[model samples]
Target: MTAGEDISVRRKKLRYRAWHRGTKEMDLILGPYADAHTEALDEAGLDRLEALVNEEDPPLLKWVMGQEEPPENIDRGFLAEVIADHSARLAR
Candidate 1:
C-alpha cells in the first residue's frame, strides 16, 4: 500500500464521520470504501494530489468538484478531485 492510501484511510474517520451517519461508528471509520481507496490509489496518484494541494490552485479544485463548467486545470487524479469528492461527501 502507498503512503497516500494509508493517510487517506487514517484520516477517513475524521474527514468523513457524517458520510456514514446511520452506520456503526467503527464500520464507517473502517469501511470497505476506505480499504478500496487505499488499494486503488497508487503512489503517483497521491503525488499528483499532493502537488495540486501544495500549489493551492483553486481552479483545479473547482474543476474537480464539477462545481464550475470547466477550467484549465482539468486532469485525471489531482488532489482537487480527491478533496472535492471528500467535500461533497462531507456536505451531504
Candidate 2:
C-alpha cells in the first residue's frame, strides 16, 4: 500500500479497536472520538492513541470519566484534547 493507504488502513484498524473494546461505555466514548480524530492524527499522534487504547479499560475509563488523572507516562498532548472533548461532551 502507498503511504496514504497505509495511514488509512491504520486509522481503520484503530477505529475498529476503539469500538470493540469489550465494554459498551468505552466503545461509546472512544468509537466516536476515534472516528472524529483518527483521520487528523500524524504518525506520532496515532502511535500515542494506539498505546492509549491498548491500556486496560479501568484506568482508561478513569481518565475519560474524570475519576482520576492519567499518569504522566500515559498523558500525551493529544490525549489532553480528547479528554477535554470528552469532558465538554459530558458537561452538555
Candidate 3:
C-alpha cells in the first residue's frame, strides 16, 4: 500500500481502539473525537494520541476534562487543538 493508504489504515485502527477502551466513560470521551479527527492527524499527532490512550483513563480524563492540567510535554499546540475541538463538541 502507498503511504497515504498506510496512514488511512492506521487511523482506522486507532479509531477502533479509541472506541473500544475498557471504560464506558473513556469510550464516550475518546470515541467520537477519534472518529472526527484521527484521520486529520499527522504522524506525530497520532503518536501523541496513542500515548494518551495508553495512559490510565482517570488521569487522561482529568486532563481532558480540565479537572487537572496536562503536563508541559503533553500540552503542545496540537493538544491545544484537541482540547478546543473536544470542548466545542461538548458545547454543541
Identify the candidate with maximal lDDT: 2
Pick by TM-score: 1 or 3, better one: 3
TM-score of each: 0.32, 0.85, 0.78
Worst 10 residues of 3 by lDDT: 73-82
lDDT of 3 at 48: 78
Deviation in Å, model 1, residue 78 alpha carbon: 4.2
Superposition TM-score, candidate 2 onto the true structure: 0.85
The model with the greatest TM-score is 2
Considering TM-score, where higher is better, how would the candidates rank from best to worst?
Answer: 2, 3, 1
- Candidate RMSDs in order: 9.2, 1.7, 2.0
Q: Write the per-residue lDDT of candidate 1 for residues 1-92, one digit (tens) a residue.
A: 99666766645542353233343532332233344454454656544433433333344435544666444554444434455555556678
Determine which window of 10 residues in candidate 1 has minimal summed lDDT.
25-34
Instruction: Order the candidate numbers by lDDT, best to worst.
Output: 2, 3, 1
lDDT of 2 by residue, 26-69 (tens): 88788878988899999987998899889888888888777888
